[model samples]
Target: MNTVLVTGASAGFGEAICRKLIADGYKVIGAARREDKLKSLATELGDNFLPLQFDVTQKDAVDNILATLPIGFQQIDILINNAGLALGIEPAYEADYTDWETMVQTNIIGMMHLTRTILPGMVERNFGYIINLGSIAGTYPYRGGNVYGATKAFVKQFSANLRTDLFGKKIRVTNVEPGLCGGTEFSNVRFHGDNAKANDVYKNVQYITAEDIANTISWLVNTPPHMNVNSIEIMPIAQAPAGLNVSKEM
Candidate 1:
């Protein structure tokens, strides 16, 4: 069985992906800042799951934790960069600048740091796979999606560039972008714990679930090594890009 390291494994798509991968006979290192959550998940998953607690937003923490992985889990065949977030949905003019900093640090800097750390080993062994979780917002600009969308755009281009840099190597890189996903704390976090507002984002709407993402990842990992999936964009059937707003003065 291959070993995979997944960041943000405590919740949302990360948690779902861990469960799916473990069920498919892969050893998983579930890394997240919440030790309690990761520990509880490990207990349920048994020996194949390793709870790795550390904040991905901190470069030193990621460097230390990944550099000294335990004996059995030292060799990571796949890296799943699932840790990211969106802050307030307020428009750029009224939005908090702090939120933008957090998004850039976690969504861009932290991800790049961790990827750089793991990539060398993959190159040395000539085998690896990297899957980044991007968002449809990257390509479609919407109100209040300013910084969040920009970071994801970086992720998309970063994944593409990694493939270019690794040309002729066995490593594979993919960017998975989803639209209007629910069943997670994403909206709640964006709303700063306002459950009512978060809940309202999905009410009466058929949105994508965490499990759906996990399933897609599983399919990617199981695909033939000779094939490479550059990027995949998925949206709930009920969700689509909005048309340009028109201001009319009659």
Candidate 2:
């Protein structure tokens, strides 16, 4: 059985991915900061799921915990870099500097650090899959998306560059970008706990769900070893990138 390590597994897409992968018969190590939530998931998932508690934003903690994986779960054949977030939805100049900093630390720095730590093992074994959770915001920008979108764009390009560098060998790198997903803490975090405001973002719209993303991942990993999917972008029928904005003089 192959071992899979997923970050941001406490909730949202990360949580759903863990359940799906386990159901598909793979041992999963779910890493997130919320120990209580991870414990609950472990209870429900039984022995197949290993709950790892640590904030991905902290490189030291991430490195230390992963460095000491137990015997049966040590070799991670698939790594899902799903730990990321978006803060306040204010425009670039009006956005809080601290919020920008937090986004950079978690989305860019943390993901790279964790990947750096794990890539060597995958290379040595001559087999691995690295899937990054990017966003449509990266490909198409919108008001208030600012830094959050920028970080995802970075992810998109980074995945491409990684594939370029890993030209040969069995290792594969893919960037999964989704648009207008709901049923997660995404908007709630961006709105800073404003349930009403967050709810409004998805009200009456058939947005994507965490399960949808998990399904995509399951399919991606199940594909034949000879084929590698470079990138995939998904969006709900109700959502599509609009044309560029225009302004008129008063």
Candidate 3:
């Protein structure tokens, strides 16, 4: 079985993807900051799923996690960079700099650290797949998205450049951009533990589930070795383009 490494594997798309990949016969290294959640996933998924605990924002923690990988598990055929979140919904002018700093650190710097650390091995092997979790906000700016959108925009461009740089090397780089996804911890995290506020965000809109995104990822991973999916953007029908909106005065 091929080996895959997935960050943010405690819940949401990360957990779902790990489950799907394990079912598809991949040995999965599930990394997350939540030890209990990771342990539970490992238990449920059995031996194929290995739980690793670390904060993606911590460079030392990330490096230490990599160092502790089991010998045979060292060969990572696929890397899923999925550990990221938005901290606040405030506009750029009103948003706290702390939130912006957190978003940049986790979404951009953390991703770069892991990618740079693991990419050399892939390059040497002449085979690899990198799947980044981007957002529709990356392409279409929305009110209150502010720095979150900028960070995902960075992801979009970085993924593109990575694909270009790895040309002719049989390495694949893909960006999966999702819009209006619910049934996950995303909004909850965004609202900073305000469950009621998070719930309200999706109450009026049809949303995609974590399983939907996970299935898409599984399909991409199962494609023919010669085929590379560069980018994919998915949204529920209820989620029209960011441009299509009816505003109401409060």
Clash count, one per candidate: 0, 0, 0
In candidate 3, which residue pairs clash? none
Candidates in order have lDDT scores of 0.95, 0.94, 0.93
How close is every model to the real structure, measured as TM-score?
A: 0.98, 0.98, 0.96
Superposed model 3: Cα runs more than 4 Å off? 242-250
lDDT of 3 by residue, 176-246 (tens): 99999999999999999999999998998889999999999999999998998889999999987755777
lDDT of 3 at 118: 91
> Model 2 over residues 94-153: C-alpha lDDT tens digits?
999899999999999988988888899999999999999999988999999999999999
Q: What's the ranking of the predictions by TM-score, best on top?
A: 2, 1, 3
lDDT of 3 at 192: 90
Error of 2 at 47 (Å): 0.6
Give the number of the best model, judged by lDDT. Answer: 1
Query: Model 1 misses residue 29 by how many Å?
Result: 0.4
TM-score of predicted model 1? 0.98
Q: Single out the weakest 10-residue window by summed lDDT for candidate 1.
A: 58-67
- For 1-250, candidate 1 gives per-residue lDDT tens digits of 7999999999999999999999999999999999999989999999999999998888887788777888889999999999999999999999999999999999999899889989999999999999999999999998899999999999999999999999999999999999999999999999999999999999999999999999999999999999899999999999987878888995
